[model samples]
Target: MAQTADDAKYLWQKKLDNGHIRIGFNDVAHQEIGEISFAKFPDNLTEVKLGDVILSIEGAKAVSEVHTPVAGKVAKVNVALKDHPEYLESSDEDKNWVVELF
Candidate 1:
């Protein structure tokens, strides 16, 4: 596991067994965004570069944009969030992950 941001407030990276990379948010990010109300993600984006906004999470406190940490093709998204947005606050770090980049 790897983390960006001095505070580790949001971003994390992990290399999978297949040598692909995955990036997502940590628990602290959810705290910063407060209670999650909604989330939006691009439907047809198969590739992304570092700093690309892959997702946007809206919460009671504010709307937070989730960026890619490295250039890669998107492998999957946590579709569960579409119905259970509250998981951003209630789920563990692994479960709260918004997307998987590979």
Candidate 2:
């Protein structure tokens, strides 16, 4: 995966080998949100425009939305988050990733 910084604060974009885009939160975002308790993502959402809200995260301090930086079709999501929401607290790239868009 090739990673790039998005213009939006705390958002990172990763380019997958198959030319898809992966969206994730950076450490700064995790710090701002506090401990994450839950995450909600759109179900069966295929197409999305730039800046579309794809996921919502609830933390101890506040709720924040994760938006798409580029227009694309949803390919996959980190379903692990459904059972292990605390994974959002991780700053590790492999753990904090939220979704993949193709």
* RMSD in Å for model 2: 5.9
Off by over 4 Å in 2: 1-7
- Candidate 2 lDDT, 57-81, residue by residue in tens: 7788777677788889888888888
Residue-level lDDT of model 1, residues 1-102, one tens digit each, is 212233245767778788777666667776676788887787786899877777777878776677776778888878887887887676475667766777
TM-score per prediction, in order, is: 0.80, 0.86
Please give the CA lDDT of all the candidate structures: 0.71, 0.78
Candidate 2 colliding pairs, count: 0
Q: What does each candidate score in C-alpha RMSD?
A: 5.2, 5.9
- The top-ranked prediction according to TM-score is 2
Model 1, CA-based lDDT = 0.71
* CA displacement after TM-score superposition, residue 47 of candidate 1 (Å): 0.4
